[model samples]
Target: MTDPCGECGARACEELFHGLLALDHSRAEPWGPLHGVSVSCFLLQHAGRLPADGGAAARGLLQAYLDGGLPAVQRLIGRARAANSHRVKAGAAPGGAARGTAVPVGREAPRGGFTVTIEQVAQGGTFPAAGFPERVRAWAAATLEVSGPHSA
Candidate 1:
């Protein structure tokens, strides 16, 4: 569904994007021990129609982030790191974050339309490297509520 304020909708997307970036920054050290340590993937699924001024919305989001300065980014990273550390201690698996069901809004997506996939590698803890892929796939399958080999 369309947000009453388009600016607010854009800001929400921007915040989520930044949060993912912060998560990446915090996981950097742990991920350093692995191959392809610099790789990251993000998928943003919007509920409604994209704004006509998508380019302008993107530019505004970038400008906002830039105006926030490095200190703000650092703070976000710090908080993410701390939360990740806590999760590790609690025996949670290290990997990309998972979001729950997507709430419907706006116009419905066309039948068999676009699909987004996000993948990330997490390090640290006793998790086996060889089984990581399987775990990720399983998680994706469960999250998307799909069956079969190409669930994600």
Candidate 2:
């Protein structure tokens, strides 16, 4: 295979990539959205804690976190994009900010629901630049066909 994206020294992004693959193999369709959940869980549980915001140092740390999963996320997005199926965009819900809307940091529902948004980052232009988690959530919602609060 031609280094499709000319990935240079991106070995760093492999760890998270493998984790995602493992997830894809083990989970069901609805479980698809769980990609972000599994990743976040792993990040929170392991890989040490990350600071949400800060200076350059903080940004570097976050980048490392992202880079760690860049490759895998790239692969997943490639598969989804190649499938070429359109789904409702995440965050484009009703009564709130649209997908990609930068909101104040707080625990708040973003309008109708979290809409999935995908953007090209680097080589191959299939991977996400930043919205990996949101995309996964959107994928889950679209594939699972579930919404609203669970009746307990």
Candidate 3:
């Protein structure tokens, strides 16, 4: 059977997922090393696979990140990093394996999904605290197709 996400042709979701992975891997200069892969990315990527409530759940988490500011984003990244480490140790692909693969990343569905995390120390403290909000805003716009006041 075709994967539910593929069947639904959720290209936006897939793009967001891959984009987030690239961002996480690259440790972009402004972001100062994202702690882990975002759970938001995973949910959006597999939106079709989620239960009926998945959209709302994913939106809520994303909103929380938007509203939460730098500290909150940092905390979520921490969780993602921990989850990622666990997956790696378990011999599972860090982030959903090879797409289309049914590898569950911790929990799934309306409750929310999972992501892997990374830890690295930047020589000069994290990216400027003021810059983080803008970075996230840009990320939301570029990756999620999110625009408008909420995107910032």
lDDT of candidate 2 vs native? 0.33
lDDT of 1 by residue, 17-83 (tens): 4443554455543322211111111121232322333122222222222345334434545555676
TM-score of 1: 0.23
Error of 1 at 73 (Å): 1.5
Ranking the candidates on TM-score from highest down gives 3, 1, 2
Candidate 2 residue lDDT tens string, 1-152: 32211121222234434645554566545334445443332222221222231112222222333445445544554554555444536544222212333222442222212222111111233343255454544433321221222110
Error of 2 at 138 (Å): 22
Candidate 3 off by > 4 Å? 1-16, 31-42, 51-60, 76-152
* Deviation from native of the Cα of residue 4 in model 3, angstroms: 17
In model 2, residue pairs whose N, Cα or C atoms come closer than 3 Å (at least 3 residues apart or on different chains), thus clashing, are 17-72, 90-115, 90-116, 91-114, 91-115
The sequence of per-residue lDDT tens digits that candidate 3 reaches over residues 76-119 is 65665676775466655344333233323553422212221111
Q: TM per model?
A: 0.23, 0.20, 0.34
Which residues of candidate 2, in runs, are more than 4 Å off? 1-19, 25-30, 47-152
Task: Rank the models by lDDT, top first.
Answer: 3, 2, 1
lDDT of 1 at 99: 40
lDDT of each: 0.32, 0.33, 0.40
Clashes of each: 2, 5, 4
Structure candidate 1, residue pairs in collision: 1-105, 1-106
